[model samples]
Target: MNKLLIALLVFLFFSCAKESDSVAKKRITDEVFVPTLKIDSTDLLGLPKDTGGIHKGYLLNETEAVYAHMIYTPGGYQESGEGYPLLIFLHGWGPRQLTNEIGTDLNVVKEHGPPALIEQKQWNPSFPFIVASPQLEGQYWASADVHSFIDYIIEKYNINTNRIYLTGLSLGGGGCWYYVGEKGEESHAAAIIPISARGEASIVSNLTNTPIWAFHGAKDQTVEPINNYGSVTMVNEINRNSPAVIAKVTVFDNAGHDAWTRTYGNQFGETGISYSPFNLNIYDWLLQYKKE
Candidate 1:
C-alpha cells in the first residue's frame, strides 16, 4: 500500500482504540462492578448485649455482705464456652442514691451502673463480657467482697484468664482503683477504667503495666476530678518508666459527678469521653490490653 494510505489506516486504528477506551470508562462511570467481602457474624470478634436480664446475688459473710447485679453472656452464664472476659463493675455510693437504709433492698443498685445501662438505658456491650456490678453495703467498696467475688466468679464461669477488666463510677470508681491497689499485678485484670473516682497515688505505683483510663467531670462536687483523675495522673507519673502502665484521663467541663453515665464502655453510647449528646467508644481501647 502507499505510505499515505498506510498512515491513514494506522490513524483510523488508533482512533478506534481510543474510542473503545472512552466507552469502557463511560460504562464504569455509569455502573462499575464493585466487589464486597462479606463477613460472617460468628467470625466477627465482638460481644453481645445482656438484654436487660440482670441476676441478683449476695456475697455474704458473718460480718460482711455485698449485693451484686450480674449480666452474663448472651448464651447465658453456664452456656458461654471458653475465653469470656469478666467485667467487674462497682457502683457508686448507692445507699443514699438507691435507698435511705442499707436494709432497704437491692432494687436501688439496678437503677444505675451496668444494671441501669442494660436494663434502663438499654445499653449493649459490644464485647462478650460477663459483667458483675456489686452494690456496696455501705458508702464504699469492701476489699473482702471484691476478693471473694473474683474467686467465686472464676470458679463459676469460663473466664478469660487474661482479659479481665475492672471499671466503676464515683465511689465505685475509687473502689475499682482500690481493688487494683490490693491486687496490683496479681489482679490479672487486663485493663481498668475509673469514672469520677480516685485512690492514693502511692498504691497505684504497683500497677506497673496495667492500663487505666479515668474520666471525671470538672463540675463534680460529689467526688472531685482531682481525686480520681489526679489518681490517674499519679499512675502516669509512677509508671512513667514502664510502657505498659500508662493511664489516661478524659475530663469533661460541664459533666457532674456522674461521669460513669457518660464514660462507660459500649453503653449509653459506643464509648468516647461520653459527652452529654455524644459517645466516644472506648470499649475497643479497653479490649486492647491482655495479661502478659
Candidate 2:
C-alpha cells in the first residue's frame, strides 16, 4: 500500500508541474509575442536586405527643409512577429553644395560603412531594427525636422515605442541635446546619447525623468569641454532634487571634438569612428530602461 501511495504522489507532482508550465507559456505567448505592424517599402528607405548597402537621400523637404538618409535592417522577419527598436542618428555639417559625394564623405561616413553594425547580417537578422541618419541642411540644426521625422518613422513602421534611441556627434551632438530637452517625452526614446555636445541647463530640469548618457572630450576645442559642464552640473543638481533619474557623464581624457570617434568606434582596437560598437553599447544600455 505504501509503494502505491508513493507512485501516486509522484504522478500528482508531475501533473502539477506540467500545468504550471503550460500557464507560463500561454502568458508569454499572449504578452510578449503579440503581432506588430508590418513594414512596407514606403515605410522605410534602403533595399530589402540589411547589407544591401547604405541608402542616401532627402527624407523630408519642407519649408524649413530637412535632408536625410537611412539604413534599415529587418530582423528574421519569418521568425519574429514583434516590431523592432529604432535608432535615429543625426549627422553634423556636410558640404554646403549637397553633392552626391556628400553622402559618402569621410567625416559623415567614417565608421558607418563596410563592417558597420547595421550591415552585419548576424545582428540584423536576429535583432531587427531601423536606423535613421539625417544630415541637416545648410546652417540648420537637426532639432526641428529630425523630431518630426522620428515621429513619422514611428507611425510608419509601427516601431516599438519603448525602444527608441538617439545619438549624434559635434553639431549633431548639440542637436541631440536640443531634441531630447524639447521633445523627448513625445519621442518616447529609451535613452539619449549625446557625444561632445552641451545641452542647455534650463532643459536639464525637464529631463530629470529621462535617461541620458553624455560623452565629451576633455581636450575638445571646437565645442570645448566646459560646454558639457552646464549640462553635467544641471544633471547633478536635478538628481539631487530627484534621485529617481539615471544619468551618466563620461569625459575622455586627451580626446577632442571628435569624441564620437572613440565612443562609437571599437574600444578594443583603434579604428575610425563607426556606428557598430557604439550602436551595441547604446542598445545594451537602453534595454535596461523602459517607459512606465
Candidate 3:
C-alpha cells in the first residue's frame, strides 16, 4: 500500500509539472512568436498589396536629350486606396543637369525648408500630390520637357486624372503660359499660376475655358512688368472670345524677379520665412480650384 501511494504521488507531481511547462510554452509562443509571423502595415519595403505607400524622387528621360527630376507625393488614405492630386513645378534656369538643378536651384530645402522641418510643422504627410520639378535640358525651356514629365507623373503615380496644378517662376513663368495657352487647356490642370513671365499672345485662343492667375513684380528686372502686355493682352483677347475663363493678374510693387518667395512662402512657418501677404493670398487662391 505504501509503495502504491508513493507511486501515485510521483505521477501526480510529474503530470502537474508537464502541464505547467506546456502552459508557459504556449504563453511565450502566443506573446512573442506570433507577432513575427504577422506583417507590419508600415513596412515600405514589404510588397504586401497596398500595405504601405512610398514617396520618392525619380529621374525620367523625356526626349533623347531631355531628362528631369520627378518628386512624387503618395496618398495617405487608409481605406479608399484611391488616386490623388498632382502638382508639377517647373524650375527656371540653372544647370541643365537634372540632379544638379534639383539640388541647387530647385532645392526644396533652400526654398521650402528641409523635409524634416516641414514634417515637424505638421504639414500633411500624405498630401497625395506629386510635384515634378524638371530642369530644362541645355538651353531648353519648360515647353520642351514639362508636359512630358507631367504625363509621366500622371501615368506613373496613377494620379487622380482630374486634379492637376501647374506653377513656376521666371522662365518657368513663360513655360506656364506656353502650357496653358498652347497645350494645357485640354491637359488636366484645374488652374494655372505663372510668376514673372508670360507666354505668346497668339496662344491665348485655346485658353478661353482655363483659369489663369499671373504674378509679376512691379520692380522685376529680368522679366519686366511691361511683359504684362503679353499676359494681360492675351487674357483680354481670350475674354473677347469667351468671357467664361477666370483670368486675373497681381503685381507686387516692391518685389523683383524673386516673386516666388511671395508666391509660395505662405502658411506661416511653412517655409521658415516671414509671412508675406502675397504668400497667404496665393495659397488661398490655389485651394479654391480642383479638377472637375
lDDT of 1 by residue, 61-175 (tens): 4223235444444443344545577788777665333543434544566666666665564556556567766566566676666777777777666777677788887777777
Better of 2 and 3 by TM-score: 2
Residue 46 error, candidate 2, Å: 23
Off by over 4 Å in 2: 1-66, 75-80, 95-126, 227-231, 237-243, 266-280
Q: Is candidate 2 or candidate 3 better by lDDT?
A: 2
TM-scores of all candidate predictions against the true structure: 0.68, 0.64, 0.63
Candidate 1 residues lying further than 4 Å off, grouped into runs, are 1-73, 76-80, 96-104, 227-232, 239-243, 265-280
Best by TM-score: 1
103-213 per-residue lDDT for model 2 (tens digits): 453235334421245544323322345666655556645456677777777665646667677877767777777776777456566677777776666666657767777
Q: Looking at model 1, which ten-residue stretch has the lowest summed lDDT?
A: 269-278
Query: Which order, best to worst by TM-score?
Result: 1, 2, 3
CA shift at 3, candidate 3, in angstroms? Answer: 99
User: Model 1 compared with the native: what TM-score?
Assistant: 0.68
Stretches of candidate 3 above 4 Å error? 1-55, 60-66, 74-80, 98-128, 142-144, 228-237, 267-284, 290-292
Best by lDDT: 1
| Pairs in steric clash, model 2 | 111-274
> In order, what is each prediction's RMSD in angstroms?
10.7, 11.7, 21.6
